[model samples]
Target: MIPTKEEWIKVLNEKHGEDVQKKLSAATVAICGLGGLGSNIAVSLTRAGIGKLILIDFDRVDISNLQRQQYRMDQIGEYKTSALSENLTLINPYTELCVHTVRVTEDNMEELLREADIVCEAFDKAEAKAMLTNYVLENMPDKYLVAGSGMAGFDSANLVKTRRVTKRFYLCGDGVSDVNDNIGLVSSRVMLCAAHEAHAIIRIIAGKYEI
Candidate 1:
């Protein structure tokens, strides 16, 4: 098993600088949806040396998703969780990851939270986020949950902001909206929100950034 702190930083410092290695190697994050936003978040976190990662996504890759998601055309039809988990392990062999290829629901919320130190909500559906948030607020008040909103267009840069949606939950995405119902996202907007989600997780772990 990889040591959560010292050993991780000692090896990771060669890839990330000292501060990033220290901050990220101490953190465990869940990228709950391996879609456009979740893909970016997981990639950045692995690169940053986040100690443990949890990937939860029931969806399969589609050609449409490849335009914004980090996965390649060859990965189509693969489960998002499995592909992302596989890639993350390849990126950093020492970093631990759990892959859950099931949708998050009130029924399995407890099961999902059991292994994670904090949760990240990358679901695109409003109902899923609401259910996940409600479950956390009612049953797991101590855990952290970070989320995103308004990231689907070229103007997504203007939308990425970090703010507390609740006491222990954070919202990271465009505060403003340019994502129409039919709008599509570029890699930039999706990745911007994703990076903010990774940063929030790292900050929470380092006792610096608060939800």
Candidate 2:
């Protein structure tokens, strides 16, 4: 039988106090890219009792994504947001969710992010990240994106050394120039970035740090 919200609260409170649970249950977060970083972060957020999750990504799962993405082999070729939404429902049936298969851009930025409490920019494209940063800074000035940078190489791996940019936005993964401009990252480093991104996202959503 499904427990009531009170029961859920009791279970959560056993490990955490009312404040943390309240923060997790009241925030609405939008996760973009649904790839390595976004996928793991979504999973963490769902399990952590985030009241709502807005998953946005137009990409389909590939064999490559399965290694680091929070997806199974059966999810290949499926839209990422849909796959993750379904998984999240199983993880936390109490959590509300919104799924968007469209990519975030200047034209659609405001509409897509209007209701989001915070935005997670997990896309690997430099141009897209720059555009999103400008869009949020212009239209959604109060919001933030826990972005990733300098995560190109599998060798440039270190999760604990990641740094936050502003109170809201952060640059996880290696910040040095050693990150290859063209080399692709492996699962280890990608997941490392995803974990830090998830942590920053949690802290932001909890209102521990403002943008």
Point to the candidate with the largest TM-score: 2
Error of model 2, residue 52, in angstroms: 0.8
Candidate 1: where are CA atoms >4 Å away? 1-8, 14-23, 176-180
User: How many Å off is the CA of 208 in candidate 1?
Assistant: 0.6
TM-score computed on alpha carbons, candidate 2: 0.88
Off by over 4 Å in 2: 1-5, 176-182
Give TM per candidate: 0.86, 0.88
Q: lDDT per residue, candidate 1, 1-211, as tens digits? A: 5455566567778766677676666667777788877888888778777778878898999998987887878889988887777777777766778888888888887887776778888888766767887788779877888888777766737657899877788988875454556676778888888888888887787677554
Give the distance in Å from residue 132's predicted Cα in candidate 2 to where it truly belongs: 0.8
Clashing pairs in 1: 159-174, 160-174
Local distance difference test, per candidate? Answer: 0.78, 0.77
